[model samples]
Target: MNIQCPNCQSIRITTKDEGKKVGGVIGAIGGGIHGISGALKGSQVGRAVGSIAGPAGGAVGSVAGAILGCLIGAISGGVAGAKLGEIVDQRILDNYLCQSCGHSFSIICHAGHSEPKIVGANFFNLTD
Candidate 1:
């Protein structure tokens, strides 16, 4: 409820909408990287085995390649997703200003962003 503004040390409202678009962009980038990795891996594996399996083997290789690609993509995507989430939570959703004390600080969230908790040391204490 009470967030210290990083700039002026005034308590201001932190809105959830502040960084939603940026977070989404981050996720999309991550997902795209994962997808590309999957595709490349799958193609490599398929090509290696396809020549040996005849027509049926080629089909099987394609399927196997897809599965492998998807698995890798999912894993990479998950990591990217988490990082993106953290960026949103900390940089966008959690920033605020405090009017009462004029003390600006950041509350460490699970993903390393700042949110206001009732009792935590001010992240930036100018006097102290």
Candidate 2:
């Protein structure tokens, strides 16, 4: 979407994806922690399966399974987090950035009117 800077009327706008970045980090950490249980289960399964190949194979399989489990959990969590962060961005954060004037703001729509509201600044109607 093309967005113009409310302060300078510049069309160069950047999205500060703070929520997405932060959420992804937090989610990855949480997912990694949660995946520990899965990893242990996977380790047992892998050991059982690899027993046909003897001790060396079982050891390798256990490590591989644990790593795979953790990776899957982290990836899934990061994706979920990013999706949630997108919602947060749309709902709560002033996600728009103006490249020309360095003004950060969000567009607020009320009564069918779309107006730019600067973050951490006083509210005023742009139409006025």
Candidate 3:
């Protein structure tokens, strides 16, 4: 099915994949920063625990703590990034823009029906 522009009745439309890609990149960067923060916190805690156990113990504990922290941070960051990307995709990247009149809109479908409808048009106040 073809989607027409509400402003000019043009069939030329574009999807917002570029927006999605931008969102994904932003999410990944945020996630990486969060992960780094988590890793630093984990290492600090580990070092403290190791110091109480003496020099050798502290050294071992710090290494173990850093490794564990890094793993946890990476996992949490990845999940958070994926969620953010999905949110961006839904809220900003899944739109259909009119190429002819420079109008931005979306295609919506009601429940129990397959036909999509166009929104963002001032149908009641159409201009010649």
What tens-digit string does per-residue lDDT give for candidate 3 at 6-50? 777788887765555555566556656666666677677877898
Candidate 1 Cα errors over 4 Å, as ranges = 1-34, 95-128
Clashing pairs in 2: none
* Clash count of each predicted structure: 8, 0, 1
Superposition TM-score, candidate 2 onto the true structure: 0.81
Task: Tell how far residue 74 is off in model 3, in angstroms.
Answer: 7.0
TM-score of each: 0.45, 0.81, 0.49
lDDT comparing candidate 1 with the true structure: 0.57
lDDT of 2 by residue, 38-90 (tens): 78888888888887799988998898888888888888888888888877776
Give per-residue lDDT, candidate 3, residue 76.
62
Candidate number with greatest TM-score: 2
Is 1 or 2 the stronger prediction by TM-score? 2
Ranking by lDDT: 2, 3, 1
lDDT of 1 by residue, 3-122 (tens): 445545445544443344454565556666667767777867896789597877877787788777776766666666666666665664443335554443445453334643343344
lDDT of each: 0.57, 0.74, 0.63
Evaluated at residue 4, the lDDT of candidate 1 is 43
